[model samples]
Target: MKTKERKQEDKINRDLAENIKQVKKVFQDCSDVIYREIQLSEHIQGLLVYIEGIIKVEDVQQHILRPLIEGLAQHPQADGEIYPLSFTRVSLSQAQSATDWPAVINGVLTANVAIFVEGMDEVLLFSVKGGSRRSVTEPQTEAVIRGPREGFTESLRINTALIRFKIKTEKLKLLDMVIGKVTKTDVALAYIEGLAEENLIADVKERLENIDIDGILESGYIEEWIEDNPSSPFPQMQYSERPDSVAAQLLEGRVAIFVDGTPFVLIAPVTLWQLLQASEDYYERFFISNMIRWIRFFFLFLALFLPSLYIAVTTFHQDMLPSTLILSIAASREAIPFPALVEAFIMEISFEALREAGIRLPKTVGQAVSILGALVIGQAAVQAGIVSAPMVIVVSLTGIASFTVPRFGLAVTVRMLRFPIMLLASAFGLFGIVIGAVWIVVHLTQLKSFGVPYMNGIAPYVPEDTKDIFSRVPMWKMKKRPSDASRANMQRIGKSRPLGSDSNEGW
Candidate 1:
């Protein structure tokens, strides 16, 4: 059965009737598939095959149909040979000829008009890539005050064009591939030919080619398949809706994976520092950027350990707090029946549920619902003596801190790791928190993203790369890309120059 099917798909039949029969059989019950027969001349006939709603109807009428009908009427073929319609008549730039049934079917499915001429064993494919897709708009998730407002859309070509607008150079290469057995989704791997490591690009391509899936509807599907460590809770590859963010990563010698039908593009060989940093960091002045980054760092810790710390301090080491503060906390919990651990768990779980609910609900009511729900539930829980007020405050702060982290993937990972740390604190107090932190650091050090260490510069202690890690130095001061991802052509900037002369300082 497989052999018969393969033989049928191997080549196109010279007989137009037989070819149409096979195509119609394959596309049977597919209402969107359109087949229109056109007489090229008195002796020659051709069939135009395409899928509706994907190809441009106006283009078909103006460029393909009308032009072919008029052009063929003017030049009658005496030899009865089919004229090359795609080369001589069609205005479309993207045109190809295929000699197999599978190629013709694939082209027709992917917004291309396939012309099957009578007595010819080849099909002419003209790309008319058109569909109603979401336009480029401000990214909903990764909004910035100082950077480019335009974000990637669901269209793959539009996303690539956006990146190309930022980095206008021939050296910026985008290698395209078709993945998924059924969907045949278009995926592009982008990188600078000289800046990105050759080995890294090869490895990424190999992993992507190895994907044996039926369909890839989103970038997340590719992310899961190509990442180095799937078991790690921490995201091995960072995904971003902002084209500026992806362009910045490319400039830093990292490669980006653009999957069709998703605004989020995945950046490979990501580090913990890259995930923590936002696109606006470079857009703003160094001083302000550094200040905001420090705040984000502080909140990152709070997001991970605030509830656990509260559980540990209240349950185990009450003496660690100031006497007055400890007394206030104890008094708040006096009316509460549950212990600190139980109280903390209840508040944390409720806050997470509310947050998820807010995200799942429509935008207009989502924020309102989450905010009101948290406030009402916290107040009622405190008044009802179910959870202490301090526990509520801690959970609220933790939730707020999670939002401060720029990347949603990293923020989610922090939120997930929070519960485990909280459980540890409940079991072993501060010691457990310390142990959890150590384990995380160890895992991070061992983790890799496309052969680059997840902790990269910090764990290995590369002095050159540290310039952008803990602090945001002036762009001129940094002369090289991160050492882990880019192996050659490391110098990205020239020597630093003073902005003003000492003599003109007064001015």
Candidate 2:
């Protein structure tokens, strides 16, 4: 009985709380000193503790110092003391303890400094949590031709405010959690209370509570760690850098995880449709949006399979291509000694390399690389016969197709998964490509983002969730919540809009 109780106590001890000993214990063996100091004064006495860099210097000086300095000027006291402040009540997490580093780190993550009062062994935890965040600006990746121009900033508070500004619903609830032992990364789980399912909430919270990473730099860490099958190359979590995208997810009853220091917020559990979707689709006319959506969907396959199809057709399925086209390809590869696969690898890898180098290089050099890559390399390679003209065409088409994929993570995955499919097709022809595709589908079917099915809605065939999936149905027509999110309130818009429901007058 005693052993069981001790085990239970240990479990409780490790959980998040407003305790000093636990925090210090949590952050132990650190290079930085986790100091706990107390100074007395005639006016007031309190604790002053902080980690370097994490806290803003001016904020501590102006807000924390002015009052404390004035109090010390009036009230002179010894090092060992305790006193209360008469300033405005600051709303934040407060705790008392002096134990372990892990617990201390957790305390600091809660945006509190460890303070030990003179008389009391109990420590004081101040709520002065402020971190440096990037300024809000236009989203570079998700840039829109005609839509809301604002993008999400790195600040969690600002991101939440953006969502709040959009939905403006009391039902929108943000549940905050701190993950990682050393880093103590701030993670906020935002969802609509009525719309989100209780079970899913519990499941998400439970899964998060189980995380044991040392540091969490971005939402990707949480996404990678919490996924049901991390081994799968396909991304289970849907990530977006735009506020509108996150707002839309929240409206669909999906929970958004906001990690400090990253503009990207993760939404789960998502279907494949969510990853394929671009926020720009909804901002435009419905007809145009549907057409673009179809184009993107078609090109996504094109990007993934174009190169492989070229290799397979030239190697095995020669009859599939037109005789004229065959002659042109034959003319191109006639000078090249290497097979289709080798030629493809040389050009594709060069293109990918040039693409990566361009991003890393300065503006002048990058633009030069782009021009050289799109024009110089392909043309030069075809002229030199290092890669066939047909291979160059196939790689060029694939690159363009990849550019059209809206989701950055999924786009990267598409680029990554392409090479293997190319190799397979080179060996076994069309049969190899089919096998690779089957493998992807089977893996996707088994994958889960935070325990939510990856292929939900489309595969399971939930009709209610189809409104915003492939095509952006008219706003008025999307009357129900997306089903995969397992929201509690399935109905979104009823006979009335919640905003203007309260009428002014009968006249």
Candidate 3:
């Protein structure tokens, strides 16, 4: 049965009318598909098919239709040689010939004009790429004060070109493939040639090719499908909208996956440290960067453990606190009906809901609603004697600390794990928090991103990678790419100038 179906597959027919009939049948309900008939000469006719809004109408009018209409006086023979000879008179640079219906259909769908002629068994596809798309703008998610202002747009070629502008070298290889059975989304795997490991590239390629989804509308779809562990709450791959961030990752021997319609590109084999560091970290001075990085690390702990610690300390280990502070907290909670754990849950949940509402609301009102809502509700709750004042302060601090993490994905994971840690602390005090921390550490140590460890620099303990893991050292002192991802060619910098040297002595 499969053999018979293969043998009966549709091919381009020599009869122009029959081909048009088949194409119209396939696109029966698609009103956007436009079909135009052109008279080439007294004996032969041609059919032009393309989608309405995607193709450039001006190019089709000037380059294709005008040339063919004017060349009618030449009066060529109606042979296989005639179509090839006539196409030369046109000025379009990107053109290809397809012998089957599938290829022709795909070409027309992807911003190409398909030309069908009489007495020809193939269709000519001319690329006239144009459409209304979002222009390049600053990335709203990964905004920075000291970095490039331009962000990636939705167009795949434009995104790749942006990266190319940063890394101007032939060694930056972009391997393209089409995925999704219905959407046929264009995806490109980008990495530097000598920097990235051969096996790592092959593994990424194999994982992508193995996906058999119906459609991919965004990079997140690909992220969900090709990630190392779908069940893990921690993100194995980092997604960024900034071209400089993606280019930086590629230079570090990581693979960047670009999907057609999303501004965010997925970078594979990312470590926990990479997600914690922001693009501005590299752009700023090393001393300032190190200080800010240390502050971010301190707040990261607060974001995850502040609520749980408050519960554990107030409920089980009150003696650990200073007597005056403990007395103040006790006096504040005198009128509260709920226990410490229950009060913390109420405040945390309410705060999270307000934050989510702010995000989901319109931009003009979202920030106002989030800020005002937090203030109004916290004040009302305190006056109503529902939640203690200290609990409110802790929840507010936690929310603020969460914003400090550079990567939204990792921040979300930390937010999600907070509740369970709170529950653990309520049941078993500080020891419960210890258990949860140990479990998370174990998971991070064991998790792999495209065969590279999630905590590559810390758990595996590569001495060379430590310079940029916890604190980024000066750019001049860094002389090697990360060893975990780019084992083949590790050196990325040469000898640096001495600290006080005025002469141009080193690169």
Candidate 4:
């Protein structure tokens, strides 16, 4: 009975009297949905509907309400497009002639005012979207010293406009669609036409269109649905709040997915190496960027394998350490009651708990809490003989190493995989650690992101595309985009000698 009543209320009628009743009933108890009825002319009337916070009050009064009251409705036009009004632009919608009631509701909800005239069987959609959207701010998580500071905000149009401002090209195409049956959220798929592979674009579009969910609250939802390897610990899609980062990826022939109401945008056909890169890498000098790149690469391995290495060496291969170091480690562990594995698990879990608490708590207090917790907990655990000093040192180093990773998603993956590797090391010592490492490598080799290999240009190996992989090379030396991400438009620049400019200047 309730469902029937709701469906009936959604149906718009030609009779103005009946339509007003149905519209009011459908939006019952929703105070934000405002309705204003005005006598357009002596015998004609019009109903204006919009959400309270999403629209500009002055625009409605000046553009919409003024023209109707001034006698434009004296010769009311049946076609909304031809209807002369004070408004600069208007779109005509035939919602009364369709079953897509959700579209009509969504248009109004997103700041398009709906006008239903007394005699017309259609609604005029006016665009006067205005609200207190967040201004562009620097991305906190992906801060860069040399690159542009502006970042994507929760507003989808603003985010897209940021990208458009950077690219400034007709080749950049954005395909829009509405996802979520209940939420009816807007989603935009962006890519460069000639650069991005045709198959990649089609694959991304297909995956997005096939998603059958009640709502997509964030880009993560679409990412989980569309990922080629959902079970893999490695993130198949990259996320960034920086518009410059997105523009760079688009130029490399990868597609970007923009979801409404979130700052994070999803980039597809991402590789493990790409996730490790920072926007500043391209902004700074090649030598400095390469040094930072090498440091990140070293820390990545340290974060993943440092704890496991300590567990394996201390438990089964003490000979791997020097005589003095072995003696020192043994003395440090003398008061410890638990074995190496148990001590590691306890300290690692404690560190993880503190890290999470730091993130959840207030910013000023979070840092202090995490710092004090680590110092107090580590010292107390050692004093109580629950954990050894050496184990504490290992965990602290591993935790520090994890933070060095550029992407939080990859850092999380590393953190998760650390425990499993530690468990394997506890069971079979160094041999088990090796086995875990091998398994991880094999899994990465098989993984793909929207049909592009997750380990692209490495496991399969592309020589020409390796210039900016491990280290940043001089810009003049690099002339082609990554082959794996772009099958077409591989050439980036014309070939030239580094000193050709000097010679051409007649020096």
For each candidate in turn, the TM-score is 0.96, 0.81, 0.96, 0.92
2 against 4, candidate with superior TM-score:
4
Write model 2 residue lDDT over 46-111, tens digit each, in one string.
456577556665666665555455544123238633333322233233435544444544666566
lDDT of 3 at 45: 83
Q: What is the C-alpha local distance difference test score of each model?
A: 0.89, 0.74, 0.90, 0.86
> In candidate 3, what are the lDDT values of residues 311-363, reduced to their tens digit?
99999999999999999999999999999999998998999999999999999
Better model by TM-score: candidate 3 vs candidate 4? 3
Could you give candidate 1's per-residue lDDT for residues 49-117 as a string of tens digits?
999999889998987888677754224358746445444567778999999877888999899999888
Candidate with better lDDT, 1 vs 3: 3
Which one wins by lDDT: 2 or 3?
3
Those runs of model 2 whose alpha carbons end farther than 4 Å from true positions after fitting are 1-47, 51-53, 56-62, 72-125, 450-452, 496-507
For candidate 1, the per-residue lDDT at 132 reads 88
lDDT of residue 263 for candidate 4: 97
Q: In candidate 4, what are the lDDT values of residues 13-62, reduced to their tens digit?
A: 66778778867876899999999998877777788889988888888887
- Candidate 1 lDDT: 0.89
Cα distance off (Å), candidate 3, residue 501: 5.6
Order by lDDT, highest first: 3, 1, 4, 2
